[model samples]
Target: MTNETFRALVVEEVNEEIQAGVKACTLEDLSAGDTLIKTSYSGINYKDALATIKNGGVIRSYPMIPGVDAVGEVMETTSDSFKKGDKVVITGNGLGVSHTGGFSEIVRIPNEWVVKLPEGLTEKEAATIGTAGITAVESINELERNGLSDKKARILVTGATGGVGSIAIAMLKSLGYENITALSRKKNEDFLYALGATKVISLDEFMPEKIKPLQKQEYDFVLDTIGGKVLSAILPQINYGGAITLCGNASGIKLETTVLPFILRGIKMLGVDSVQLPNEKKEAIWERIANELDKERLSTIGAVEEPIDRIEEIVTHLLEGTHSGRTLIKM
Candidate 1:
């Protein structure tokens, strides 16, 4: 791999401005790792969009590649866990932040950050699942562990149009969940319903003019992607012994709420961290997603596919909160 050149979406801070564009690079210029992979596919996350903007706070360093999710074939490896021609999937563990990441034609990462693509999933399918799918599965697993067993139990999914929410709703339906309510600011009720949401509630319709310490019991489970006031509003309506999983914070980080729901109703708030989760656990979730989620259903969740060269357009939409569903990036 002496002088092999490839294209990478390089983000650099020049004179206090963030500038990102696809640029030609070489193997030696990539971050040092035991394995070299030829990226087959990558996916855009909200964090990836933020990394391209000044003061976005997603990137620890500039002149870096900013993709947290990648699926590819191994080109070379010094690690015992992988060899040439093996297919692998990678996400998290400082990727696209502290470490140079996967928004490139090729990527080099530590083997520990790698999970061999499960047999049930193709590279494109796995990339489409990506980090968002993993987070959704993990969140559901946590809820299940907390006694979410009733198929008819009311479940609310916030930020319902985004990747995690959209995928979670579909996966839950496949698992025989009968009652799923989607909460979204966007007017995409048809899309959410197509993904099997039993009901679609606009954000305005779900939020009360005043948030009380406790409200009438509504949902038995809530999958919250947005934080801040939206999360604060959902807490009061959760049933006794219910649970809510907190994953993405696209709505803002600060959560203003009371512990009355916990103290009075025994509600549980589980925070999910997909990025720093152990590789072993990630593998389990990936396998579950690959096997339990129907490929045909997965294909429809986020059908938009964009090449790396056209990423800037999507990035703008993501930052503006106008984008919905997953967007797969072709490497």
Candidate 2:
């Protein structure tokens, strides 16, 4: 392991097909970064799965590492922000998409993208509450607490079984939001309950209840992961002045909706792109997740701490929609 060469999941395009596998590579050949990390953990994300398949176009260059989350100890550093042996977590900031990412034994990244492992979190804990956890926390926080009613506010979280959705349920529960509905495939009902979902509804069951450009005001706030039609369908149902933090496109990328929700109902659709958010904002969210997101709940939401090999399997399963909950990749 001490050798200059280490194993990595390399994604290369061949004859119009993107192929990925574990290969040996040297540190000098890795992506450019100001600091080096002896990766202790990482997570399998949807974007990582895209890198291994043809037509995803996730990798800007060939022979790329396709993982977005990394948590580890600093091995070397040129930036004053971190030192050797310091624990840290990283996600997004063009990580697996462009920069060589956490799918390898080691990762070198810009110091600014790093968040020092805050109190109340370990390498495994940080990875479980990786970008997904942070995104949920940030989305929940986007609602300004300006003397607004707390528990009385209704919140709906869609795609509750996915990484972001599950964590959002836990976060809202911890923050005292009780009138919450979690939408997911019926098979994940038990899993959503374990993650503190008060009410779990089948994605299939919820659909076809009613469809309208504007319906009865229901949820005060909505956290939509299954965007596209789901969002188009839910937007009009949101209570006037309510907000929906748009996160993922798991349902569909193309949005088909009218301005009825935005104009007629005075609804809001806040786009949350975890990949390109400010580094400082991400660092703040990581710290808040450590402090406020509640560790006990995070672990209960299917946190698996395993060696890096698990990441390869996790990424594969994620693409197939088989991997359930969060996977913390330990190196």
Candidate 3:
């Protein structure tokens, strides 16, 4: 691939607005780093899609590649952690946000951001899982911290139709958490059931007649991707000594609620930040996701492979909440 130019979805912000296009550049145009990778695949998350909007979604600067998750072979490396041709995966840790991300055929990132792609996961699969996998594993770890058990306590996953929600459900099922309830806006009940959801409730059904400070005891473990009233509503439903992991603020970051869930029910609210997780904990969680996560089931849940140039349209779908599952960008 010497002297060959490749396609990349480059986004530029003008007057505090975002503009995206299929920009072309040589490998030399990539940012300076320890390793240069020929990115085979990258995953499009909400952040990546936001980059194509009128302003920066995750990108801190304009004229930057916008992709948070990528996995490919090393083309060059200066660090001992990796050598040329080493296969690896990367995500989060300010990748698409503050760094020259993974939207192109080539990427340059610190060797510390690189980790050998875990056994049993392909470049495509790793991109499909992306930061969503890390957040799911981290959420479960928090659940375990609060004594999550399989002894009849129900587990509730909100935004069950989303990438993170889908993977979390499968992980819970693999861990023998069968009593799982899924809440989604989609009418595809069978899809949720197939993904190991014991019960599927439409968003309409989930809305309570009256959201009280506390409600009848319910879920022991909760993985929420949508924040706002949905999160506030779920708190009242959490069982005594239960735990909830807050991963995304997609619905809204502004939370207004009383502390009755903590004081009266003794519930634990854990925050998950896959983007800035400590390097050591991130590595441990990545290993767990690679080892314990069912590869077959992960693919079954969702993995859409589209050309990198189609990023403009994908962003609109994701922000509109019309997309489902993980969307992979084939570089």
The TM-scores, one per candidate, come to 0.98, 0.94, 0.95
Look at candidate 3 and tell me the lDDT of residue 321: 82
lDDT of 2: 0.80
Q: Which candidate is the best by TM-score?
A: 1
Report the C-alpha lDDT of model 1 over 1-331, residue by residue, as the tens digit. 6887889999998988889999999987688888889998888888899999998888867689999989999998887877899999999998888888889999989878989998889988888888888899999999999989999999999988988888999899889899999999896988988888999999888889999999999999999998989999999999999999999888899988998999999999999989999999999998898779967667668557788998899999989999999888887
Clashing pairs in 3: 17-54, 18-54, 18-55
Instruction: Indicate whether candidate 1 or candidate 3 has the larger TM-score.
Output: 1
Write the residue-wise lDDT of candidate 2 on 209-251 in tens digits.
6677888888888888768778877887888888888888767
Candidate 3 residues lying further than 4 Å off, grouped into runs, are 1-3, 55-57
> Each candidate: what lDDT?
0.90, 0.80, 0.82
> Which candidate ranks first by lDDT, i.e. highest?
1
Question: lDDT score, residue 330, model 2?
Answer: 65
Report the lDDT of model 1 for residue 120.
84
Stretches of candidate 1 off by over 4 Å are none
